[model samples]
Target: MQWIAALPMYNIAPALADDWRALLGAVLGRISPWLDARGDTVRIVDPGADLTAFWLRDDVLLSQTCGYPLLHALSGRVQLVATPAFDAPGCERGGYRSVLVAGAQAGASSLEACRGLRAVYNDEDSNSGMNLFRHAVAPLTSGGRFFSSATKSGGHLASLRAIAVERSADVAAIDCVTLAFVRAHRPELAAGIREIGVTASAPALPFIASKRVPKGLVDALAAALSDVIAQDEALAGRLRLRGVLRFTEADYACIDRYEREAIELGYPRLA
Candidate 1:
């Protein structure tokens, strides 16, 4: 059977894109030997691919999905493989936080100071990009909104650019890991953006398999990732693999709680 794989969420810093692909390819390559059926290559889905649709496709063998989407948009549609642990700031074990950022010229020292600024986000379904950031801003929102205007930047890196380069927005919430990667590898992109605050932590983006895949294959794939972490220190270092943790549906339910809390707190939506 034909299958596809993607890690769109963490594919920041174009310079390191090939390295990331190779690392994923190696992990998947290691797992292929145990499966009766496997693809010789991992199809790195491009930016244009509709990722929500891609996640629901039956042929998706491995892909990383945000916790918010997994709980709100993709519940029961995919099976968790494992959660990647990154050795980056704002990341703890298999959980990560969102970094609230503003343009250097905006002059907002903290989240509270940016009361009526324009806000940008990658997507509404994104945990780090939207959900967590919304929750962070909820308490500060007096009315239905806090931002004077909100725009969708299409992706985290783009959201960063919208604030720092395009100057179209004053603030945005970026995935901490993505921000960390860009700072390390593509410092130019992060030049004018300043991280002023952080959102609450939640389960990291999860590696998932289509439900159509057999349980045995899924188990083997999880084991393969573990083996890669244990045996290939160099590859794991490149991927920033700390350890893969098996997260349950309950663990993901915490994401939904964040949404509910935001609603109950009177800021149901990010302003």
Candidate 2:
């Protein structure tokens, strides 16, 4: 049997291959021989791609959610295997909050003070850098006149750089995960920046498998992950995956609630 897994590339750690191998080994166990006695071929798909193609592929077994929109799109179509939100025995809930970061010299002290100031988002499809920011500021505007201007920075790291270097935007909303990654690996770039505010806590990324997969295999994989979290100290620290939690279902309706609230308040374009 063959299986495919896709992960996001944004600030991905350099130890990704080793991490995957440990994770797959723990999850697949003796079944690994059946997969490939010599080696199992794993293919990674870009998280930014329109994942509808991967979701429709019969050969793919799993994919990770990069943001809420992608998760919403896949809800009814696939089986949600595990999520950080479930707080599986070894997994912890709540990672980081999106922050409104401004240049240290800009002198803006609060969200209200930044009005009429330019803002940057990672991407239109982004949940933390886009949707949450839009929803947060929507109620403050009457006719979509919140920010002076807005643009997509393509990725969270770019959004951070845009504010730090070009000073093009007075502020930018960036995910906490990206911020932590930058601080850990590129402290120089992360310096001279301050967080003005943080968005409400939301669920973290989820690990998912297709519903078409056999239930027996799914159960075994889940058990394996739980075992690794409980017994394998090296694997746990490397993957940062605490444990396997029970899976739950959520849909576009949850996302629609936020969009609807923003639209009703007259801030439809993220201002």
Candidate 3:
């Protein structure tokens, strides 16, 4: 069967789409020899495809996924390979946090000040967009909810527009790396949004392979991922990719903890 790969978490906007494509090409280039030796072929898929269906495909050779779905819906179906380290704020040691953002004119000084405002998020399954936002708001809820209403904006950039440009919502949680990318590539949009705070940290989104890929190939991919980032300074700087960290399923337990903590606090959903 043919194998597919994508790095779809942060490339919706036209400004940074080419950067993601460059990063994907660099990583795949590093691993091509190993794949060729195994008589394997890999193809790049559109980052704009329906993410949930794209992720679940049996022929998945590599992809990046949020920690929330990896621990919940995607558990057992995908194999963890390595975590990409990023240079953005709220990111360190291959772990990341969700950046809470409001409109540039929004005067909410802190998270608590944004009470009862409409909340926008990317997806229910997204860690940075929903899960981390819930965990942050969980302790602030009065009647099992914090926001006056919740709206699904489909993606982080869309959520940002809802807060900054469209003015339909007052708050949102975006992956810090994606926020950094926006600030660099699409400054106009970034300038309209104000970051209020960051959520608790979880392992960054990880590179994953389908269950069919063997252990040896997974290790090679991880090694190549690290080598490419460290040595390819141009690509690394462009993407803000710092380095890589190979991890097992155990390294991601804290993602499960984030959800559990939210449930314990009585905020089961991002309402």
| Top candidate by TM-score | 3
Output the number of the lDDT-best candidate: 3
Question: Which model, 1 or 3, shows the larger TM-score?
Answer: 3
- Give lDDT tens digits, candidate 1, residues 136-213: 998888877999998988888788788888899999888888888888877877999888999999988999989987
Q: How far is candidate 2 from the true structure (C-alpha RMSD, Å)?
A: 4.1
Q: Which ten contiguous residues of candidate 2 have the minimum total lDDT?
A: 85-94
Compute the lDDT of residue 63 as modeled in candidate 2: 58
Assess every candidate by TM-score.
Answer: 0.93, 0.79, 0.95
Q: Candidate 3, 54: how far from true, in Å?
A: 1.2
**Local distance difference test values of all predictions, in order:** 0.82, 0.64, 0.85
Task: Rank candidates by TM-score, best first.
Answer: 3, 1, 2
lDDT of 3 at 239: 75
Model 3, TM vs. native: 0.95
The list of candidate 3 runs beyond 4 A from truth reads none
The C-alpha RMSD of each candidate to the native structure, in angstroms, is 2.1, 4.1, 1.5
lDDT, candidate 3, residue 49? 52
Which candidate, 2 or 3, has the higher lDDT?
A: 3
